[model samples]
Structures are given as structure tokens and as C-alpha cells.
Target: MNDVMWKRSLALFAVALLLVLGGCGQLTNSSSTASTGTTSNRKVQTTGNYSTTGYNSVVTEGHYKTSAARGVAADYANNALDVKGMETGLMQLSQDVFSPNKYTFQEGQYISAANVKNWLGRKSKSNATGLNPEANGSTDPDKRVPEYLGTMVEQDYMTGSGSKLSLGGISIALGMNAVDYYQKEQYGATFQTKVNKDKQLQEGKTMAQEIVDRLRAKNNVGNVPIFVTIYSLAEQDSLVSGSFIAKATATGKTIDKWDSVDQQSGVLPTVNNQKPINSADATAFNNFKTQVQNFFPNLSGVTASVHYLDGALTQMTVNIQTQFYGQTEIMSFTNYVASVANKLLPGNAPIQIIVSSVNTTQALITRNSGEKEFTTNVLQNY
Candidate 1:
């Protein structure tokens, strides 16, 4: 692929990656039938891959479009960010002398470079000027059982030493339709506009379970290390959607944000001074305990209190404390993860942590309110 075509190919990859866990409300009821009509091919799956026939998917049913991977066309491969990719990306992102080789694309029915380049989507929006990936049923697809993940996500935290693919750089901006592929196929824009919600949710659940399993294998494999993970996505009562991968840390410091009506005062920070918190962070803290057992001659179980300051700014504050322990290199660990995260995926994306015998107290201001400010205080270890 030449620079232009190769650029577009990369752009298409970006389009395929901005996937959210949008789909049917819940599969709890019998009346909620699948919006996707997978009967056409009889042997196709929806993962926004090459098989998708729907708007953003390949599977089609009724008037609503589903997954492009499940759709009729077949040029795209499965999510490169799949478990396979995540593992590889993490490994790659861990290098001191970062010498990343050109990553090869997963095998899909090969489409010509020209086709990918000039490919404008099926239809077009009038009076608009841009390029988009066309729906030219050009490539054939791979038919195989996907390599799945295990049941624990926290265990899959990309820690230790390895390099990984950073998903949100130019890769995300273009492939996800931010730069426009051909015409109406600015695919990223079409997700919410075209893809089915039920399918996305189902995919999310499957992916979630797989992520959990892998995480457990990675972190817990060697004597149950304290594994930390940040669980993101929308959750309320029994209904939850969307999913995310976050840094695993031993610092269980989180600020809960509630209310959507106002940003100025609806969100606030909370400090957890109690033991046993979110599972991911708790595990991370435990692992830290093992690592630091030899230090802080006088260490006792302490807690980081997280409380929200119900006010105009939506923030979370954590009060770090310890019952028994010594000086911790908190900044060093945080920096290391931040560095790895930057190398793998570049952006302002937040990283979560689970802490042990140290009190890491601070207010995380989430809202982009004007120019940001910072303040720090030195406290006694005792």
C-alpha cells in the first residue's frame, strides 16, 4: 500500500476501533429478539470485522443495521485490539529501547490497494465533500473460532515488562472515521447512527468475561499477585453498557461522580477509609503488601478515604494512610504505569491504581473547566 492507500487502510482500522458497548438493553427478557439477521450467511459472526454486513456491522436483520463484520463485505479483520492484540501491545510497550517492527495485518480476503483507496461507501450524502470506505463487497473472509479470553479482567492488567499497541493515536482518529475514508462511510460517525445496541451489549459481555479471564491468568498466575483494574462504562441498577480496559494499581482511591444535570456541582470525590474496596484495586493493594512486607518496620492495615466535595467541580479526593509501613516510591510506580500507558496508547485517558500502606490523597478534577490548577501537601507518615 502506498502512503495514500496505506493511510486510508490505517484509517479504516481506526473506524473499526471506536467500538462502544452499544446494543440491546438486556437479554433478560424473551421478547427482546436479536436485531441482527444472521441467517443470510448462516455462518457469520458480528464483531465489526470483515464479515459485518450491517451499517457498522456485517449482520443484517429487519430495517436496523448491525455489525459490519457480520455484514456482507469482508475486507476488515477482527478487532486487532482483541485479546491477542492487547497482549502483544502490552509486551511491545514495555521495552526500554523501543524498536517496534512493522505489525502485519490479520489475514482477511485480500482486497486490492486501489479498491481500498477509491472505495466510497455504498451511498453518499449530497452536497458534501470527503472520502469514505465504500461498501464494495470486495474481499472474502476467515471462518474460524475466535481465540477468546478467560473469566477475570483484573488479572489481564498490562503490567510488568512488555510493549503493546496504543489504540487511540492516529490509528483511532482515522480508521474510526474521524478523517473520512471515502464518502458516507466515515464509519465512526455511523456507529450510533447505524449499529444495533443489543449486539454491541452482547459483544461487550463476551469481551468482558474474556478480559477477566486473561487478567486473572496474567496477574494471578504466579502466586496470586495483587491485581488492580479500573472498570469503566455505563452502569445503573441492572442495566449496564460499554466497557473499557484500565491500568491495574494497588491504590484503591476513587471519586464517585453522581448526577448528570449539572457538571459544576453534580460530581464530587470520596475517600474510602475502610478496608476491602473495589475488587480490582483491592487485589492490587494486596499484591503491594507482599512486595513491601520487608519495609516500614511498623506497618498496619490503613485505608485511603475517598469523598466527594459536593460543589461546582466534579472531583474525587483520596486520603492516603497506613497502619504500618515505611516510605513508598508512590511517584515512581505511578510514573512507570503512566509511561507504559503513554507508549501503548497516547492520550489524556485516566489510569486507575490500587494502593497499599500509603495514604495517597488528592482531588481528581475530571471536568475540563477552564485552566486547571494543582496543589500538594506533605503529611507525616505516622
Candidate 2:
């Protein structure tokens, strides 16, 4: 099936599943608390930057057990607090982000009731109570497998007081598939919905408030600023703010307030003055897109967005959608786009390229400094 047809079919199937499994109870998981330790033995240290030691300890102590959860937690702990005009000297308070990596069936896939039961049985061996809490003596056909993910916390250290004030942020991950299911059931909504419902915002606020209460009680810190981030894991795993659902900030004893996740933007470090995308840059990018279309006639779409900091281009994200014949085709197309983007963009800034087909998603982070990170995941086979 074509991409458009595949998406429609998935939506229909989700609606059917919801109808068949209506009135199911929400999934929940037990929280396991791990103590936030001192940084005396930490190998890395920076005076004003976010605490690398604290982040590493969170991972090392098994606060975040899954790779996906840890990846999300680390991204927030490292980059969320250092926005362009934000204050410095904030330390990640705790690394425990959240619980429950809920199971989600990807698009273009279906499971028989027997198979789901078998899968749950296998998952139970790893966790004492099984991954799906609803599976205990329940015959719900649409049960969810919720496993503990991880957590991340950031705080500000008070100078000359030897006390760390809470001034950073915390992020929790809600499995994307679970979120998709809930959104459909709650509002019959699609992913294209620009604004989240008030109910969703309230849920985020409650989560943030709970985190603040726990942190304050644990560290005896006074009222300080905190940003609570909620990440929804999609096919492409990245901490780009756009991929998140809600980002809320709170201070003192006040309740956490939610902001528009759709209006979020990101800035790269090292650039001093932020600048808009100039006509020349846009023309160059358009020319490159034309070249890509000519070379890869099967490509469905190509687009790019530039990120600036202090009047200098610091990063650009290029997204491409096409049907790939195989892994080789996907890699070749991605590398070619990376090369084109590198030449089109100025300076030593990084470029993130995302290529998506019907059942596969691949991403590449490339820079003029010769640094690269690539990841590819095939959700299904044609």
C-alpha cells in the first residue's frame, strides 16, 4: 500500500480496536526510587554547564533502564536547560524521569488475540507481574504493556551557600503508540491536531507538580524554577522539542503551567546572534531540493528548516519522505542529502537529516567538523 493508504488503514484499525476494547482501565506502573548521589567520584565536571556527572550517575544507577528511555532522559538533562537566553549553573536534580514503556502496535501491523497472550506470557518472565498490569485475571483484548522507563532532573546550585536550588527541568516519556491510542479514543483525533486538549495539559501539569513535590521533599530545596517536559516517543527517536507534547514551567509553591508544545523552537550553542532564514539561504536550499528530486525521482517530498543562534546559522533539519527498495537505498539517499545539506549550509554547524518511508525511519546528524551519528529503524517489511 502507498503511504497515504497505509496511514488511513492504520487509523481505521485503531478505531475498530478502540470499539472492541472500550471501557478499559488506564495502565499504571509501580515507581522505584533510587537515591541521587554525590559527584565526588565523577570524572567529568564543568563549573556552569549542566552536571554531566549527575546525568551519568542516573544512567549508571539503573534509574533509566531502557535504551529509548535513557536516550530521551539524557537529551533533556543535557540540552533543555541551556536554551539561548536561559541562566546557567543548573544541575540535573535526579535522573529518574518516569515509569512505563507501554507497548504500542505500529501502523500496518496486526496481532491475533492468541499472539498477544503469548507475547504477554513471554514478557512476564522478565518482570514479576508481567508488563501489562491489566493482564492479571483480565480478558481485555486491548491490554497494554507498561514497563518502567527512566527519569531526569535539573537544579541550580546556590553560590556561597553550598545548597542547590531547584531551577532546572524534568521530562517524562509517554509511549507514542499508547498516546496515539488514547488520543483517538478521547477525541477521535489524528496526529495533525495542532493543539493538545485541556485534559492532556492538565495531566502534564499534575505530573510536573508531583515531581516538584518529590524533589522538594527529598532535597529540602526552596521554591525555584522548574520546567517539566513530556516526551512522546514516535517512530523517529529524538529529543527535538517538536517531538514533545507539553513543556511546562513552575516556581515557588504555585502549580505548574503548561505551554504550547506546537510553538516550541530550538537553538544551537556557539552562535551568538540569531538570524532569520535569508532569501539566499532559502534559494540555496531550494536548489538543493531540486537536485535531490532530479536524482531521486521516487522521492515524495523534501523540506528543510534552519536553526540560528545569535545571527549565525547553527543547525538545519532536513526531512525527506520516499519509498526505499532496501537498506542500501535508504542509506545512499540519506548520505546524499547530508552531503547536499552540508554544502548548502554555511559554517561548521550540524545538520540533522530524517528520511522516512512507509515502514522505516532513518536519521543522520552530520557536521562540518567530521562528527556524525546515524540511526535507522525498520518498523515493518513490505
Candidate 3:
């Protein structure tokens, strides 16, 4: 047989296998329903829930979370920082920074401001100066202390020799009211804008120094290395772009030296060196879509896109459009599409399959050996 005819036969064989595996419920359901004579634009929505049955524990829903954080980091590093990106970046960074070392903290081993004081054998006196000790007469007992987002003792594999060094790190979310005010003021015709920006940065530096000092007082941290990260929030409580604002390190002996937000170094490492999808990959993806359409004639259209990181495919998304009668048909079609794509796709990267109709949409995500299945309603016109 010619190549075209051979591909057709293979497509038909795959569809027959799908129909058999889909069972009587799907066939009966599909046969009973007729198309409503109305044509409406389909809106696509996606929701996901993960299952970690047999895959490596490291690759989980966290991968998507990290991906999002990386996107935010890229925005900041490239000077495209915006309110939404800033907020998202900080929130995701908070989750990403502590996740890898979660298991290290035992039941009561987590770090806290109060506990750190006790660990240093210091008295439990509240800071009368509140978050900013430099502001005179601002000693309101109700003033908020540095909100500790998270803290953990991480092992420094890169810096330690022979035995790994226990590195203690603290994450804090700080208010950006001063910075926001300065940003708005800096736009004015007055020369104070530059002054205000400088003052705000100085205040940020001071706050960071105070935090480090409190954590290191009287050798509280002993010989372990302590790292502190301050994430600043704008007036609306959203994260400020390029607002990794302050980072300080102390060795429990000398004073902590704080640095202004280093635009180049503050970005999370995972986001660096990402590779864009190439022409060759695009061709391969197009071929895969053609094969899928041949295997599933009911599909009205099929679209595919690939996501890459450091010259390797990290994710592939396939959207299948069709007219479906009910949930049974949707499930059957989704399963069939996922199975076919899983076989055709290369590498162990995650695959996202989105199946949509006029009024409903479903998403099936597979990563490594695990799978996440969820569905959503299409409420708006596309």
C-alpha cells in the first residue's frame, strides 16, 4: 500500500481500539444523542488535580508552581516588572524557596522570631519601635513586626566541604507603602522624586539590617550561615517589581551587611537560560497534530504548542475541539487523545490535553508516571 493509504489504515485501527476500550457506555451514550441544530462558539477553561501514584516525588504539581515563579522572575530580571507579575512572583517564590527543604524541619524545628530570641538566650521583650526602629516617637506596641513568611535550615551542598553546612534562611514579606509613595512622587516635576526613591531604598536597607541584627544578636545563630530574603509588597498589597528589595548574610560574628535589590542576582535560578521552541520542534508538533486528526475524525480542529527550558521540552499542550453530547463522550475522547499523544510525544516532560465543546471543557494532565484529571464549564463565548 502507498504511504497515505498505510497511514489511513493505521488511523482507522487506532480509532477502533479506542472505541473498544471506551466500552459500551460511551458507544451507547454517543449513539443516543443528536446535535442541537445550534452553533455556538466554544469557550475553553482548564482545572487540574494531581495524583502521585508511581512517579518520582520531586516532579509533582510543584513543577507548574515553579514554572509560574520562573515567569515572574523573568519579567523582573528583564525590567518588565508589573504589579501582577510582582505579586505572583513573590507568592510563588515563597512557596518555591521553602518546598525543597520542607522535610528538613522536624515537628518543632521550624524557625520563628520568638523562638530565635529564646534560642539566643535573650529576653522576650517586644520591640517598642515596631517594624521601623528609626522613626522617632513611632513606638506603637501595636505596630506590626516583620511578618515571617517562612524559615528553614537548608544544607549548603555547594559551599560546604566534607560535611554539609547547615544554612538557616528566613523569608519575610514587607510592606512597600514607602516605595510606592516614592514611585508616585518621583514622577512629579520636583527634584524630590530622586530623593524619595533613595530614601525609600535606604529605609529598606535599614529594615533588613535590623532583622539580621535581631536574628544574630549575641551569637544567637551560632556558627551556621544565615541568609535573609525580603519580599516587598506595594500599596495594594501586591508585590513590587524588582522588589526582592533586600538580602543579607551573616556568619554570627560580624554585623550583617545589607545590599539593595540586585536586579541581576535576585531572580530565582530556575528561570534562567530558558530556550524558546525551535522551527524543527514546531514541525514535529505539526506532524503529531496531523496524525491525531487522522486518528480522531470527530475532532473539528487540533492545536498544539510546546514549552521549553534550557533547550529541552518542558511541556506540551494539545487542544481538541469537537461537538460532544455528554460527559461520557467527553471522557472517552479525552482518554483516547491522551493515550495517543502520550505514545507519540518524546521525552518524559508533562503533557496537557484540553478537550472542549460548546458548553463544556475538560483537562487531562500527565507528568512522568502521574496524572491529574479535572473538568470545567465553558460559560462564555470564545
lDDT of each: 0.24, 0.37, 0.37
Indicate the worst ten consecutive residues by lDDT in candidate 2: 99-108
Order of the predicted models by lDDT, top scorer first: 2, 3, 1
Q: Which residue ranges in model 2 land beyond 4 Å of their true spot?
A: 1-196, 220-224, 230-246, 256-258, 264-286, 293-350, 354-382
Model 1 has an lDDT value of: 0.24
CA RMSD of each candidate after superposition? 23.7, 15.5, 18.3
What is the per-residue lDDT of model 3 for residues 1-382, given as tens digits with 9 covering 90 to 100? 3445333333332233233223321111111211111112322111121121110111112221112222322222212223323332333333333342231111112234344333222123454434432222322323323222211111111111112322233343333333222122346531111113344455555555565565556343445444444543322221113345554555564435765453211111012353323545555555667776776677655554443433555445455656555666665666666666655655455554555553344434344423333233222323
lDDT string for model 1 (309-341, tens) is 122211111112234333445444334333332
For model 1, the run of ten residues with the poorest summed lDDT? 166-175
Total residue pair clashes for candidate 2: 17
TM-score of each: 0.18, 0.37, 0.35
lDDT of 2 by residue, 1-382 (tens): 3545434433332232233223221111223232343334432211221111122112223322222323333342222312211111111111222111211101101122232233223235554422223324422224432221112323322211112211133322221111322232556543322223443444445545654565455443455444455443322222232234455555665554555443223322112354424555556666777888888988756655454433455445555667666767776776776666656655455554556654445444344323443333333334
Selected candidate, larger lDDT, 1 vs 3: 3
Q: Give the residue spans of candidate 1 off by over 4 A.
A: 1-200, 216-382
Candidate 1: deviation at residue 263, Å?
A: 12
